[model samples]
Target: MQDFLFYFLSALTLISGLMVPVSKNPVNGAMYMILCLIGTAGLFALLGSYFMAALQVLVYAGAIMVLFIFIIMLINAPAETKRKRDIPSLIAAAIAFLMLTVGFVMMAMSPELNQPMPALEDAETLAAEGAIPFDGSAKSYGFGLYGKYMLPIQVMGFLLLAAMVGVIHLSKDLHARSQAMLKVKENASE
Candidate 1:
């Protein structure tokens, strides 16, 4: 039963993840991403990390995807016209695909990948000895995030803010350029 669920969730994650990149509509792509995130949460649940699974569902599948869809709605991007694929682009894509395949194969072949996890008793012993930190609760995650990982989290927040500002600036510039183009066209027409 566990194996069946693992395979099902894995397939769901993989298929939706692939569809996210392939979907032509931005909204559809975002929806696919939500599905992928949910599948990831299911995988986390299967791994017995229920807190992480809930966090994944709430933060990523819920809030982040909502933000993404909101941004897409605001942007209201026009449909992209079909363009002919060139040989150079095709070659580059093929090379990229081959590299990804080779990387996956190498990772799968690694000795460390075959190692089994410790048993439940061993994990409990390690936790009792304060070695593994596997209390398996939201408190542990919160402490790790706010205590040891504080600096990295702050840096990530700062980077995200910077990116948001950059995006807003770029959008304003694009708007100004479009207005200028419109004025020029009107003047020429007159």
Candidate 2:
């Protein structure tokens, strides 16, 4: 059962991760990334790290993805415009893509990629031989964080708040500048 869940989550994670870059639209890519992050959280849960799983979902899929979507929509970015298929550029792109594919394949087939993670091996060994001690929960998580990670967490929270304020201030000024630019362009055209 554990093996089945692991494989299923692994496949989902890989598929979603691939879709992030394969999707034509940046918005779609960000959505795919959320799916990938969720899958990763599931994997962490399977490994008995509930705190990590919650953090993955809360931090990556929730906060980070929201920020990504906000940035994607804020600029009101357009879809990638289609370009004329010039032969030379097409050939160059093909060559570059081929090289990248080869490099990725080589890396995928490397010994390092094949190596098992020590943490995972330890988890599996414990599960197989004896009871998997339940050490992770919301209470434990809060205790651990407030005990040792309090300063870091507070620092990150303040940083994120500052960033939100910055973005809001910048966006307002950006909208005004863009409107002014549009007025100037219209007057020139007239």
Candidate 3:
């Protein structure tokens, strides 16, 4: 079941990642990117890193994606028009793909990768020995972030807030200019 899930999530991540660049509509591409992020979060979850999964979903899929879509809409990006693919470019792409495939195959067949990984130290044992255990769990991650990294987190929040305000101000200025243009055109017609 775990293997099946891993494969499913991997496929989801790959396909969504591919679609993000290939999609004709910018909004659709953003949506696909969100899916890719979500799939990545799932993969993280499968690896028992709940904190990373949550961060991936919250930061990348939710907040970042919303910001991206908002900016995309604000810019009024047009949907991509289909273009004719030239043969040379197609051949070049194929060659690049082939090279990438060969690289992966070689890496997978490397002798170093086939060796057994060293076992990790037991978290409880380390803690009992009066050493700090760096177990990658959500509880520990949250505690560390909120406890030790509080100031940095707050600073980042403020930075993001400032950015949001700036975007809003810029959008308002653009709206005002557009309104002025319409008024000028109306007066000229009369």
TM-score of each: 0.73, 0.62, 0.64
Model 2 spans with C-alpha error above 4 angstroms: 84-134, 174-190
| CA lDDT, every model vs. true structure | 0.87, 0.85, 0.84
Evaluated against the true structure, the overall lDDT of model 2 is 0.85
TM-score for predicted model 2 compared with the true structure: 0.62
lDDT of 2 by residue, 1-190 (tens): 9889999999999999989977879999999999999999999998778889999999999998998999899977789888565789768978997999999999988987877545643554565454443455688677757876899999999998999899888768787898999999999999
lDDT of 3 by residue, 1-190 (tens): 9789999999999999989867778898999999999999999888767788888999898888998999899999565556786789878988998999899989988998977433346556535564445565767777777987899999999998999899888767787899999999999999
Best by lDDT: 1
List ranges where model 3 is wrong by over 4 Å: 86-90, 115-134, 142-190
Give lDDT tens digits, candidate 1, residues 60-131: 988989999999999898976676757798789889989998999899889989676666556655665534
Better lDDT candidate (1, 2): 1
Predicted structure 1: clash tally = 0
Clashing pairs in 3: none
Instruction: Estimate the overall C-alpha local distance difference test score of candidate 3.
Output: 0.84
- Candidate 3: 10-residue stretch with minimal lDDT: 117-126
RMSD of each: 4.8, 7.0, 5.4
